[model samples]
Target: MGRTALIVIDMLNTYEHEDAQVLVRSVREALPGVKTLLERARAADAPVIYVNDNFGRWRSHHGEILEAALAGPRADLVEPIAPDEESLFVVKARHSAFYETPLAYLLGRLGAERVVLCGQVTEQCVLYSALDAHIRHLDVVVALDAVAHIDADLADAALLMMERNMAAELRPNGDITFGDARSD
Candidate 1:
């Protein structure tokens, strides 16, 4: 039996990128699910790790990155799922959270053998992160309704790949449960 961690990826964003409008639209639909997962994870006392993109702000830390997102026009989206004091933060410069990041070591330290992934860019970040986690032999779960995507078709294909190719479980946020490792 092993612990489970909720990995909220790249939800803190300024929505100032090339396809941000499309991404924001999907995110709006997915927001409630993401919020629900956050609450459930918190209530269960499971580790909630926020693995966010640094947005090329080399000097920025978690606080600074969060501040920038909250100050952006799309702050509403970030507000509901903002990382609390109990949430762990990891800044990543690449698509995969584990790439050049301490996420693997952190997960090991926390004894998290399973991870539930939620957040933006289903076709990109989420896809890559799932593959990385799969190779590392971590059980991966992707919350379908809790993830936003830029392209619908690509996102669909990505989810299939995560499920069939990577063996990542695909479930809606409502079905996800968190807590003790043995019970999970």
Candidate 2:
């Protein structure tokens, strides 16, 4: 467990597109893998950062976001749940969490030489964060089934985009065991 962090990007119950129901539906498939990764990071004392979008606004708070999401139209479909106090949450106003955010400095302080990104639509938030990691020269690995999009093509393109264009590699859950050393 070298200097690494697990970045769970935009998994908030908000911005639950693809018909809010699709959020849990899509995440249901990936949650286990993401959870496993999180657990390992916790045991290894690695950082776990939850990067979320400000959803088109600058002055946004996590509490406000959750309240609006619950009172919003998709309340039934979108379930806004809060994380335990131990986790770190980063609110961003753009696609990339690193854009005008303290993510870079936080990771630097954590001595994170690598970032494992997962969450939301692979076509959007996930892609941006991964590229930012690449630009910072941080190692990146994404789980294949752990990400998705309403438009299959967009998701496929996003995944392929990273693998071909940004040098991101896919780490399947089946091949990885929690607490196992990350050889890459």
Among these predicted structures, which one has the highest lDDT? 1
lDDT of 1 by residue, 47-124 (tens): 999999999999999999999999998999999999999999999999998999999999999999999999989999
What digit string (tens of lDDT, one per residue) describes model 2 on residues 43-108? 767677888776776687866665666776545433522344577778887888798999999988
- What TM-score do all the candidates reach, one by one? 0.98, 0.80
Off by over 4 Å in 1: none
Local error of candidate 2 at residue 129 (angstroms): 1.2
Clashing pairs in 2: none
The TM-score, computed over Cα atoms with residue i paired to residue i, of candidate 1 is 0.98
Q: RMSD in angstroms, all models?
A: 0.8, 3.3
Q: Candidates' lDDT values, in order?
A: 0.95, 0.71
Instruction: State how far residue 64 of model 1 sits from its true place (Å).
Output: 0.3
